[model samples]
Target: MIAAPVTPAIATLNTGSSSLKFRIFARDSLDLLMSGKVTGIGTDCRMNAKVTGTGAQIAQELPGADQEAALAAVIACIDAHDDDWRIDAFAHRIVHGGATFTAPVIVTPEVMAELQTLCPLAPLHQPYNLAGIAASGRLAPDAQDIACFDTAFHAGHSEVVHSFALPQAMRDAGVRRYGFHGISYEWIARMLAEQRPDLAAGRVVAAHLGNGASLCALRGGRSLDTTMGMSALDGLPMGSRSGALDAGAVTYMMRRFGLDADALDHMLYEDSGLKGLSGLTNDVATLVASDDPRAAFALDCFTYRVAQYVGAMAVAMGGIDAVVFTGGIGENAPGLRGAVLDRIGFLGPVESLVIPANEERMMAIHARELLETRLELMP
Candidate 1:
């Protein structure tokens, strides 16, 4: 009798501004072997992980507390746990792919150049993602680096959905709505297709609520419209991002406060949203726990924006058949979810469920698909 071949291990990395999350999975079955994150980089960076089935936990303090250091810690942990396991490929969650790269691609020098042009579009994220890719390449030279873009899943939206009221020349230059948080949405769509065909076939609104949040309207499992437009900063307010501000308002701030582009970017991307509004931390758990009135106000504004966008997404879908809540806050913050749902109760009779964000698994699936396709073409 012939024995079946064993698929190699695949690793997915989702790099954030101050953290890096990763998971290792069995390539053939996509069964998660272990998952963890390194958080608080630049301060007290700590790494934590647990094996999927056995719940074997691992923790460490990464001295340098940077992406490179965090990655090294992860590798060391994996090696210590299972030296026999071979890491076949490393997949990444790239924030933006611009108007091109509508699918996942293996990272090449030319691909890196094209992706660099898109960094300004997702200033807070794209650079770190590319950096992670580079880090992976250096650490594991033999493993293939596959970039699965957050913008790729929404690439199929109609021009009308992606376009702004910009001039023809600007639109020609790729200035358009390229949604973020797509990997999370794609995971939700896949889960729905497998678990609830009825809802999957109908109009659905998915709210990916986290430190970075967005809402996507889906029709038959494809993005029809999304609250986020052109940039990640254009959707609902997030932990520190000022979402959906008018262009004129930005220019006014530039003129009045003598703020340049960089300063303006910092204010919008780092100083605003929950932190700015609450005069406290951007963490939802912290805000929820606080007795400060500003905390309540911040929570109110976040929920209000979510509810507002939910209505808009519903309109975009013609009608919403189901509403999905996912991402860190969406899955874990039941009170926040209830608050948003309460405000948009009229949109009901719409089924709702909290789906945990699984972008790592989704990226792994993309990596497998791309690798398999490459193998087929190698002949």
Candidate 2:
């Protein structure tokens, strides 16, 4: 008897600073086969995975595993399971595509070079994202590698929204605002279109509140404006990242505090935001459960900023019809969501929703579309 051919699947990788979250989807059906992550890469890395719709699970400690090793371990886990699914394509969640790539594209050497130049724009994310791509290429050389950009969803923003009040030369040199958390917003838009067509057709403000938070204004399921600008460091205060800050304050810190560029970067990106404000922990659950006044103050600041941004997003679309929340805190923190909604109650009876962010699924969808398009164009 001849052996049956393995089923083709798309693997989506969302790589962070020290973590890689991944999911495998059936190529044709787009059904999730398995999902997993390798957290704390370069430290005491732990890899965990679960086969969808089953009791099969994987958990292991990978000592000193880097991004490439983590990916190799993920592949090993998938292979260990007799799922008989081969990863035919890798769909990467690239955080920044700069100003050129407006849509998902197959990764090429030229594209890789261009993306490398954008690392400065998203220092904390872009480099790791590119590392995932490079790792996938090395480990699965025959598989198609597709880059699904987080910035691609917001690439259609108008000049007024994307531009800063900088000099014409600086604006022309790609120093303009490039919104982040767009992949999550795009998933929210698609979900709304299918589940709540009424709101999807009208003005909607989506608050992706999490470790890294941002708000996006959507009109007819398209991004009109967002809070993040130029980098993920902008927008709402994150777990450890400073949100929007005064340029003057940064200059003052550099001069008064004797902070160099690296020191400033570390302080703003890793030592600020809720973590800095709370003086306890960045985890919302911890902050919410604590009796400490600092935690309460941090939570208050977070919700207040979220509400403020909602109003800004509402203004961007001329009116507000609905407010959708997603991401870790957005979907799970009912109190925080209610606080945000309550604060924005002055906008009149706007619909409120909590939609789970499915960025990995969105990447898989993009991978399938690109794959099918390639087949269609083939002679």
Candidate 3:
């Protein structure tokens, strides 16, 4: 059985670049009381709110051209719905925690500042993440805010797994392999540790594939290594983000394409990967289902890149015991999963499993502990 959280008014706030998602958990059995998202931050912002247990949904168009306006709209909707619920704690899905914050943290000025500086490392994600927090302080002042990092899971990677060929000065500047999508991996790690301790104790690889994708290698339920380096764009080819490109190739692209630094960054961060390669949809499902050769090629690129990293991760751990899948494509696209698994058959006989992505619930459970009693302190 999946473990649930115990909290009266606890909700996880997942702030993306263009949207905000939240799920409220009740203390008794930690069932979802409500879930909602305000999408399209800049204009024509839309919201879909649902009653957690009943699945009753109400849709509304929220006003906003940015994160601040988006938060106000979310707050207005929550307020309009008169309920017995009183929000006690807010857990945020922070995109980056830099070098520290391997574990969840009570939001502090120092932690917030560090996350802000790391924005350049993930220019597309960190500012919006911090913006949502600042907005929370304005919109939900009574709630005790907590931050859970997406990079925390890979904090245990070996020095070699994290190093770049650059000089020590760059490494000293925190330019190392700080992996991404850690909330999902961290949740899966704990799930495995609780329900499948044998595999949890052994070397395992968890692939989180979606619009944003990455893979994590774990041993003894800790992150041994991951595909994403200093940024989310450094891993396997994602929906629109290029993965694992040579530094020299970047310079060459700049020269040949007459690409400015910002344009190059935009291409790598937003326009490359599956979209650039396929010249079509960035979604894995779309590519896998399409009849176009380019779509097939895109699928091949994605799976091939992922499979190649699987071998590298296995090498990092000496061997892999199980290969698990999560995220949109990871859990839903069995064909894609099969393609990746088929390519890495040599790494087997590793077992494979699919677990739905549940980072929000994970954050709720984490906050539930901090609100009730620290689980680590318990017997």
Candidate 4:
């Protein structure tokens, strides 16, 4: 049998610390062509993706460990679907940009180097972020790569919003708030601008709840403030993170529990939050479904913390126009949405909306802009 020619489309990749997600979109309107994710990288990589709307899995699945191998699998999957598809560019969700990158920038060696230095700020994520970027360069050298920073969207915050009550030296060392989970919030911000322009122009609080969660106060579609400070673990209680933890307590734990840096990292990154409080699963669905008192207590803690951030962000934004939720737990978990909103009812006239998280799509949009602009500049 003769093979059919592959249709042309733009391929966008959103590689996380341990996961790689990709989507194919037609250049016109950038319609969703296909999407999938390779998970559990670096140790027993697992592939899971459902077709848009239908939720169908890919045929030749990539099973193994290692992020680079997983990435190769994603490339192969896309190539198989449309061998001739012209991958115009690649978009990456880079986690940190220090004080430099405030918007999407074309990837370069210097930019990558500056980002790598931020590994100390985001120890668990930055190394992997760099790894993913390097892999993309190697795997798809033909496509233009664009870096969309998770910290860039929050760079709009006022000095008062980002400042910490620390010494001048520490503040000068970039030890202030640099909000994370920005891609999710960025999408929500755009949704508000398009669907509810009035709210977008007014003060609003956006909670991006998921395995990793953060709240942002946005005024005029820009970040007025956010809960996360310098790292992803500083905001709301996440799937397995101890949010807003006392630095003193950490110091005490080191002396008392004989916990080293590595031990604490494992605890904060994988053993705390819902999993720690509930003594059960970190998955919100599991906790929500279970009748265990510990699970209920954990949910209560998560809800209360989210409500606290809303009030704080409301104060930061002056007042609140709307409360937006966008993330795995945000978009799908209506119960969580209600719990957070119910607690923040004291905030005047707040409307709630759920626009499913689309960081991958957002990346595609940025890549398209970068590509079109580059083409225009070519003599």
**Model 2 lowest lDDT segment of ten:** 75-84
Candidate 3 accuracy as TM-score? 0.93
Residue-level lDDT of model 3, residues 1-379, one tens digit each, is 9545433678788887888898777754677888888888787788889885556777987665578887776667666662666778789988888887888887767778877887888787888888988888778888878898888878877788889988999999988888988889888998998889999999999989888999888888888888888888897998888998989999999999999989998899889999999999797777877899999988888899999999988987889988989999898899989998899897658899987889988888888777666446668
Regions of model 4 farther than 4 Å from truth: 1-8, 49-56, 59-63
Q: Tell me the TM-score of each prediction against the true structure.
A: 0.93, 0.98, 0.93, 0.93
Model 1 TM-score on a 0 to 1 scale: 0.93
lDDT of 3 at 194: 84
Alpha-carbon error at 62 in model 1, in Å? 2.7
* Pairs of colliding residues, candidate 4: 42-66, 45-64, 51-56
lDDT of 1 by residue, 80-180 (tens): 87535678899998989998889899999999899999888888888898889888889889999999988888999987889889899999988899898
- Candidate 1 has an lDDT of 0.89
Per-model lDDT: 0.89, 0.93, 0.84, 0.82
Model 2 ranges with Cα > 4 A deviation: none
Of candidates 4 and 2, the better by lDDT: 2
